[model samples]
Each structure stands twice: as structure tokens, then as C-alpha cells.
Target: MVGKTHFIGLMSGTSLDGVDAALVSFDTAGPLTGELVHTAYLPYPEPLREQLLAIHLPGHDELHRAALLANELSRLYSRAISELLARSAMSAETIEAIGCHGQTVRHRPDAGYTIQLANPSLLAELTGISVIADFRSRDIAAGGQGAPLVPAFHAAALRHPTQHRVIVNIGGISNLTDLPPSGKIIGFDCGPGNLLMDAWCQHHTGQLIDQAGAWGAAGTQLPDLFNQLVAHAFFSAPPPKSAGREEFNLGWLDSHLTGTESAQDVQATLRGLTTYGITHAIETHCPNAHEVYICGGGARNTALMDSLRAALPGKLLASTEMLGVDPDWLEAHAFAWLARQTRLGLPGNLTEVTGARHPCVLGAIYPA
Candidate 1:
């Protein structure tokens, strides 16, 4: 297969943040060597965030509105790509393809489906590049968690043979990839990551996120409440599971909070819950990990980073900086790599990690 040296991967994570556009450069053949050369995050306009938050669980006018937003998302994605190319002194003609992880409204892997909201066909037409999207359903059809597929990218792009390592992506929902000293690679969504914390921040402070986890740092974790939250079956369930806003969303918070605590207190508990869940998973699954490499939106939380440090004492906890990849762009870069895989018809899932009956090529291609 003929390959291109550049691609644009788009990520509109569960956080409902604006699309994260990454310009990835790669040889896209033989042994995968690639880099997210340039990255840009465009925040969802205020109105769009409200619209997404409103329709998320209840689905009132959302289905109709979602269709509208889907196209709008496509336009936004196209614009981001155009802008990124412009900033990099490139053009649409220079890109090979676009890998877009549409907005994820629901991710029910057990039910044999996962939903990422975006119109890749429209994106393809608008950007004039082949698009690869709908990345989760095939895995789910194989009886696997369609979510957390990034581990495959993590292993290929970040793993080291001699140094046992873990790639922890703390996005709206947190997930981990355990790259063993050998060839075994395992991963799963540990539990709520920045999703819950971000929700609490928005409600209380009118901010998209808790900058530096400042609010959480002011409060203490309510141990009983923390345990109650962790009792969620997702934490106890084995690997091969994936979660999104469906399992841990705004309504999820309302049910858990139940009018007993302030939002700040709730935020503190939520933060504790994520760290506890991640540290526990590491201790259980990858006890030998030499270090934990942090990525995703959660890596920006200075206080959250401190908490993770305290939770996993004596273990080196650092962002992806040392690895020469920015924490913010890892997910976007993963999708870019997946697009390369789709073009090559390569299997993107580890049968061992997702419990798929067989390794299968992931994602569908949209014509330009």
C-alpha cells in the first residue's frame, strides 16, 4: 500500500471539549515511527457545550439536535485541520487522511455497541481527505470493550522491551496500558478520570475544568463516600471493559452525590476515586512497572499529579515529556496511527487485551 508522510487525527473526547486536531508525520509502513508534529485544541463554543450537556442522558431533543451538531462537528473538525495546516505552512493537499474519533455520547461495550458522535463522511468531504472513524463497534461485535483501544497504539508507539511500563490515559474516563517486560500487552478503562472531576468543576465554578485541581486540593476525600463510589462494578470488573460518559456522567454524579455534599467535597472525593482506582490497578496488574507515563487531559491537573504521586509512592510518575511526546496529543496521535492501520487493513486490537475472538482491523473508511 502506498503511504503518506502526514495525517490529521481528530479527537473530541467525552469531556465535550472542542476537537483536538493533531498533525501527525510518519513513514506509515514497515515499523511504525510517527510523531504528532503539531497540535491544537479548539474549545467547544459555549452554546455547543450546553447543548451536549443538555441532551446527554435524557435524549429529549438531542437526537434531532445531535444530527445538527454532528455536521457542525464535522465542520469544526475540518476547520481545525485547515487551521492546523495553515499554521504549519501546509495545505489540505498535503495530508494523507483524517482520523476522527467523533464525540462519544454512549459507550456500552457489553450491549455490543459503542457510539461516537460525528459525521466522518461529511468531514471527509469538507477536508478532502480519506477519513477513518467508527473505531469501536468492531471490537464490541467481537465481544470486547470497544473502548480503550488506544492501548494498541500505546504498545506500538510507546512501549519499551527492557523497561516494564504503564501508559495511563486519564481522559474523561481513565484507562491504562500495561506493557510487560515480555510481549504481553493488557489494558482497560480503570474508572472515571477527568470526566467526573470536570463536571463538578463546571457546575460549581463555571469553568470547563478544575485548573491545577485547585478546588480538590482545598478539601479532603470523604473516605466512606470515596469507597461508595469505587464500589462501582466497572472498578471490580476484569479487563476488556470500556467506559465513557454513559457509565460515569453528570447524572451519575447527581445519583452519587445525592444532595449530601458540596460540589467541592464531591470533586475532592472524585479526584481521590480516580487516583485510588489507578494506583490499585497498577499494583494489581503491573506491579513491576518501572514508571507510570501519564497522558491525556488529566495530566494537566497539577494537584491530580500530586495525588497520583502520593498514591504510588516511590514510583517515578511523570508525564509523556520524557518519552518525547506531549501528554495532550497522545490520544489524537493514536487515532492518526489507527487511520494508517485502516488504510493498510491492519489489526488494531490485541486479542489478549480486548478479548476479541480474533485480532481484527479497526475503523471504517470514508471517501474524500
Candidate 2:
């Protein structure tokens, strides 16, 4: 069978940073066997970022405007895909379809709702390819937390039988997937990732991310501060639970920060919070995990990685690059694979892992 020459995967994470575009090539044409060929992040214009962050918990009047911005986001996705193709010298005709994760505005699966801001129909109209958007709602409807959907992709992209492996994605909020040899896939939001840390860095210094943990390395990590942040019930909660900025946003930090809190001290403490939260979740769930594959933006942080290693003394911690896959591209690639699943009518959510009532075909597609 001729495989898809291309499929553009679009993702706008909780950090509200930008759209990550991955132009993937797949041999399966089926849902799960896609391979990434080219990937890039098209940053949101500052205006769009502000619009997104504000509308997540929007006012009633903002709902109508939110709809308009959804198209705005779609246009961005369209242009990013167009750019992705142009750089790769591939044309829209060559792309089989596009899988968009959509901008997550609000996700409360426990209450049977997860809204991702997107205009799939417009996206398809604009992009001239089938667009698969809104990938989480169906799972939420099935009595499961419709989030961290990338774990199914992790199971495919990683998962070693000889070793008990854990794939940890430190995005806006940290989430971990335990792909044990003997058990089924299990994953959930561990806690804060780069969201708070990035905000703090932007607040104190002028950096978007803590480069080599430089700023965080400045001050003392308050053991007491670390304990307060990590004690949130989210860490101890069982699988199928998901979270985002709603839980760990600036408000949470403000509550913890004292007037005397040094900028560097806060930075160090936030990094510790991430490292400790992820490490604690790993210990709570997969203490015996021999090796863990790190992905997402946080994996690039040397200090965070070092802290993770120290926290998990006996385990070997490494990035997906160690396994021949770029960490940054993993989640984008997952949506690409998911787009394949939507087109093939496959279940992208694993019921056992996500606690969905039943496996259901995920996502709604819009044809160009």
C-alpha cells in the first residue's frame, strides 16, 4: 500500500507559546505507524497568545469573540502548515491530511467536558486538506479524562519489553506514562512543568526559558517551599486524572510567594517543584522503573534533568534522542499518528490507561 506522503500535525499546548508544526511521513497510512520527517514551531504572535490565555476562562461576551479567534488560530495553523510544506519543498497535494490537537481552553473531563479552541471546518477550508480536530471530547464523553492523549503514541514510539520504561512529558503540566512490560499503559498529569517556571523566568529575568537552569541555579531551593508546592493532591491522585494551567497557574504561585521571595529563589523553587513533582509521581506509580524516556520542552533543561536524575537515584534518565527520536517532536508526531487513527477509524485512547468507559474512535475531522 502506498503510504501517506505527508500529514501536518498541529499542537498549541497550555504554555500558550506557539503552534508546533510537524510534517510527518507515514508508511502505515493507518493510525499508528507514522514517522516524522520535518518539524518546527511557529510561535504565536503576542496578540494571539494574550487572546488565548484570556479566553480559556472567558466572560460570556468573550464566547462570540472566542469563535472568531478560533478561526484566527486556524489561519495560523494553516500558514504554519503552508510554511512547513514550503520549507520541505512539499506541496499541499502531497499531504494526505492534517491532525490538529487544537488549543485547549478548558478541560474538565471529570465533569464530562474538555473544550479545545479550534475551527476545524475553517481550518480544512483554509488548508485544503482533511483536518482532524477536537481529539479529546469523545474520550471525555466516555467517562475518561480526555487528556494527555499522547501516551498511546508513547506506547508505540517507546515501550521496551526487557525494561520497565516511563515516558515523562514536561509540558505546561507534567505527565508520566508507565509502559511496564507486565502491565497496561498508565498516565496522568503529575504537576507543574515549564508553565510556571517559564512565567517566573519571564517575570524576573528577560528569558523565555531558563537556559541551562542558569537563573534557577542562582538561589537556594527552599526545601519547605518545595514541600508546599508538591503537596497538592494532584500528585497523589490516581490515573485518568488530567490538569493544566487552571490548577497550577500564576494564582497558585502567588499564594506561595512571599514579598521577600527572591526572583532567583523562586526560579530555583519552581524548577524543584517540577523535578520533585515528576519524581514523586514516578516513585508513587513506578518505583521499579529501570529506565525513563524524557520528552517535551522540559527535557531540554539541564538543571531539571539533573534534578530528575538525583531524585530518582537508581534509574537511568535520558531523552527520547537517546532512542533516536527528538524529544521536541514527540507530541507533534503523536497528533500526526492520531490524525492517521481518525482517518482509519481507530481508537486513539487506551481505555485501561485513561480510564475511559470504553474505547472510542477519537477526533472530528474536517475535509479540505
Report backbone clashes per prediction. Answer: 1, 0
List lDDT for all candidates, in order: 0.84, 0.84
Candidate 2, 287-313: lDDT as tens digits: 889998898898889988998998988
- TM-score to true structure, per model: 0.95, 0.96
Task: Please write out the lDDT profile of model 1 over residues 249-311, one tens digit for every residue.
Answer: 767767766687766777888999889889989998888898899998889999899999998
The deviation in Å at residue 165 for candidate 1 is 0.3
lDDT of 2: 0.84
Worst 10 residues of 1 by lDDT: 27-36
True lDDT of residue 190, candidate 2: 85
